[model samples]
Target: MTSKTTTRGEPAGPSMTYSAIQQPAAMSDAGNVLMNWREWKTLFDCYIIAAGKEKASSREKCALFLHVIGKAGREIFEELDLDDKAKTDYDELVLRFTMHCDPARNVNFERHLFFEIYQGAENLILTQMIRGIKGSYMRERLLAISKLELDDAVSWCRAEEGP
Candidate 1:
């Protein structure tokens, strides 16, 4: 079943906002919170909703996104004008930022390369496992074998063995 929502039409969950994430204090507390890529991602969605810009036009959403980020994120992006031709979907903006800033974006593939048990020296993907050890060259070679190529080879062998 679907969950309930607030009278404001937001979820029953509390909405995230600049003030919520960045608490105000005395006048001396004058600095924007420079959110990391992860925090910005999480708050970005919520900010869009809370501001009632979830269904707003792409141009509006783009402007709101940039505004939600405010001064702290100005440095992260050099050029973002809502009137620009490239100003399209808000998701596109999110993608561009992720590509530029997400540090752990390739961590999973790197982890898999280091940790997957070598199937065999004859293994099509990990084709150079030498004697009971895996050298850097072998690991490098294994990384070179894209998952699509391995999948195609597996499919070919399976087809040859027939149903």
Candidate 2:
């Protein structure tokens, strides 16, 4: 009888071995809790793809997710306000975990803070420019002006450098 050899030089037999994908680490970093959850979820997604379980049933996927998330994650999962159907849904479970890890953001508050920082940075840059002026007269004139803005400074400098 002729024997068939496998790609790894082993004989193709009924007792061939297969290795399962390694599970991702649990999300447990208290300091970086959100980041830890995001990273762990990404790794778990990769594991699902590697293990050829992408087409698995919702319940099966949910089970796999719970198993991989470890004790702390399971405790959090238990606290989530999900109905029976949602509890068995993989997507719903992921959404709940994501929401738990990341709190809701206030867009208006975030925008206000961003503008505050932006204005501060702009003022800093303008101050540095005035300080770096080669002409002492120009520097003193700019600094002496009360409530001087960037546009006013530029206009004043341009007027001084007239043709």
Find the candidate with the highest TM-score and give its number.
2
Residue by residue across 1-163, what tens digits does model 1's lDDT show?
A: 9987766666675552333443212111134322366566676776666556678988787776666565645555564343346556767777776665644547878756655564532353423222223345544444555763545445644564489
Give the per-residue lDDT digits (tens) of candidate 2, residues 40-134: 99999998987778999999999999898898899899889899999899998999889998989899899768757777876866777898889
- lDDT agreement with native, every candidate: 0.54, 0.86
Candidate 1 error regions (>4 Å) = 1-35, 79-83, 103-163
Worst 10 residues of 1 by lDDT: 23-32
Question: Model 1: what TM-score?
Answer: 0.41
TM-scores, all models, native as reference: 0.41, 0.61
How many clashing residue pairs are found in candidate 1? Answer: 0
| Residue 9 in model 1: lDDT | 66
